[model samples]
Target: MTPEEWQAVLLSLRVAFFATLVSLPFGILVAMALARWRFPGRQILNGLVHLPLILPPVVTGYLLLLTFGRRGTVGQWLAELGIIFAFNWTGAVLAAAVMAFPLLVRAIRLSLEAVDPGLEAAAGTLGASPIWVFATVTLPMILPGIIAGAVLAFAKAMGEFGATITFVANIPGQTQTLPSAIYALLQVPGGEERAMRLVVIAIAVAMSALLLSEWVSRAIARRIAS
Candidate 1:
């Protein structure tokens, strides 16, 4: 692959990594809330969490642009603090995170839901504080789910295109990720070979992540069972 292709590959990895890393804590909290907490507007929160999945990618992208663009309500305010998102690689990261968040939350939520409340109640009975109970018992049981959710979110970020492009404009070396690069190559004549190369790389990265997630989850489950 050429230098530009290499850049795209690296940028995609970087963007996806940061997007997943940054979203992990929030995803965990949101998942915990959805799975364990009974609160008003729970359904509304759930719907909003999964909204991106139901909406068109382009539409999601457009919404990001509207909300985070340079002149946008939030964007302008953020820009005052020197935190810009519109037309930047960081914007790509934000876009990818938003697009991938639902999968991350869903995976973790299911994992949390599957946990036995009895175990937690027992810990509480034994005088463990709520936070301690969660840290010791709940977190261990839900480790596999967190791993799976993170991998899913990473894979989703790797392939993110519409929101990224709309928000970041696919500038090379700055915002051109793997999917955006492939799309760009496909639009030109004689670019199929390069596009195919990227396609393979994307598939390889995604598959590797999934396999690694499976292995880690199983290993953790076995350890927990033992």
Candidate 2:
């Protein structure tokens, strides 16, 4: 592989890693809330969380550009903190995180919903605090789901192009993920072979993520069953 291709691969991995890591805690919290809590505007919050899944990727990216773009409201405030998202690698991470969030939340929520509340109540009766019970019991029981959600998010992040490109234009060695790299290669004359190689790489990454998720799910299930 060329140096540029290698750089794109490494950058994609870095962005996806950070995106998944940063979103995990928030995704778990939101999933738990949506699964177990009932409050005003819950439905609205759920809808908003999932809106990105339904919206056009370009539209979502544009909205992020508007809200988190340097000249935009929140973007300006963040810019003052020496954080510029637009046209940068951080923007790519943000776009990937946003695009993957819905899948992560849904996987976690399903797992959370499947957990028995009676177990929680039992723990509470045993003098276990809510936080303690969640940390020990609830979290362990739902480990498989968390892994699954993370894998799903990682896969989604790997394939994220529309939102990522729209938010952070394909800059070599920076925001150029495998998918974006493939797209760029496709646009160039006599670049089909390189594009094909990248396409294969993308497929391999996605398949590995899925296989890893399955393995994790099975391991967790076995542990839980034991």
To one decimal, what is the Cα RMSD in angstroms of model 2 from the true structure?
0.8
Deviation in Å, model 2, residue 8 alpha carbon: 0.9
Best by lDDT: 1
Worst 10 residues of 1 by lDDT: 217-226
RMSD of each: 0.9, 0.8
Task: Mark the 10 consecutive residues where model 2 has the least summed lDDT.
Answer: 216-225
The residue ranges of model 1 lying beyond 4 angstroms of the native Cα positions read none
- The residue-by-residue lDDT of candidate 1 on 1-226, one tens digit each, is 8999999999999999999999999999999989989999999999999999999888999999999999999999999999999888899999999999999999999999999999999999999999999999999888899999999999999999988998889888999999999999999999999899999999999999999999999899788679
